[model samples]
Target: MARGKEYGYLLDGLNSERAEMIKRALRAIPEIKSISIRPSQGTIQLIATKDPETQVKIACEVAGCVFRLKLGRGQLA
Candidate 1:
């Protein structure tokens, strides 16, 4: 892995298909190795192993208004 940073996004009110679309969009980034999603406190937590900024950009592009990312845990590796 490149080993700079990992990205985490909190997605709310999204169905499985939508989540998969997000995942696919994320995978389009060549640096991203893997992605994991789990339900947390009424939101879906998306953890992706890649550059943090790149992940956030991808999330914003793909999700648009359907989800918002938590700023706290945004940087992880």
Candidate 2:
């Protein structure tokens, strides 16, 4: 996918509480530069210095949920 392109994923079965927990966990990763919630897809987009694989691993470990990461440059960045 092109940089800055919006990616989508299904975060089904996760309620607001769980989503917040996941967001907290993801934010805990120092390498994660930033994060934004894509409510439409129920997915969280993370802007990180670390690679997608590493970010996903940390997210899974902390949130106890499977996550997929897509790399894209932010238009404003």
Candidate 3:
């Protein structure tokens, strides 16, 4: 392991109003080792024990927000 593999997301429709809910949803998952969200940049950074896309998708749904993923190449890691 190289410390941790950072997985990132370019949020399609994130705004201040929905940030808290999404952050809260992310926090519910224990495998996520790190989290950083920049509402202004419309991006989210995460490091987890495993791939987090599925959990992220679920969180977005639970928060009732629509999103589009960035490069099919995957997140920032």
Candidate 1 contains a number of clashing pairs equal to 0
lDDT by residue for model 3 (1-77), tens? 44565777777678876777888888888788888877787777887877788888887787766666743444453
Candidate 1, which segments miss by more than 4 Å at Cα?
Answer: 39-65, 71-77
Per-model TM-score on C-alpha atoms: 0.55, 0.54, 0.78
lDDT agreement of model 1 with the native: 0.54
Which window of ten consecutive residues has the lowest lDDT sum in model 1? Answer: 39-48
User: Alpha-carbon error at 55 in model 2, in Å?
Assistant: 4.3
Judged by whole-model lDDT over C-alpha atoms, candidate 3 comes out at 0.75
Kindly report which residue pairs in candidate 2 clash with one another.
none
Candidate 3 similarity to native, TM-score: 0.78
Worst 10 residues of 2 by lDDT: 1-10
Whole-model lDDT, candidate 2? Answer: 0.55
Tell me the spans in candidate 3 whose CA falls farther than 4 Å from its real position.
1-3, 70-77
- Angstrom error of the Cα, residue 50, model 1: value is 5.9
For model 1, residues 1-77, the per-residue Cα lDDT tens digits are 44444455556655666666666776676666666654333243334444455564566457652446554553432
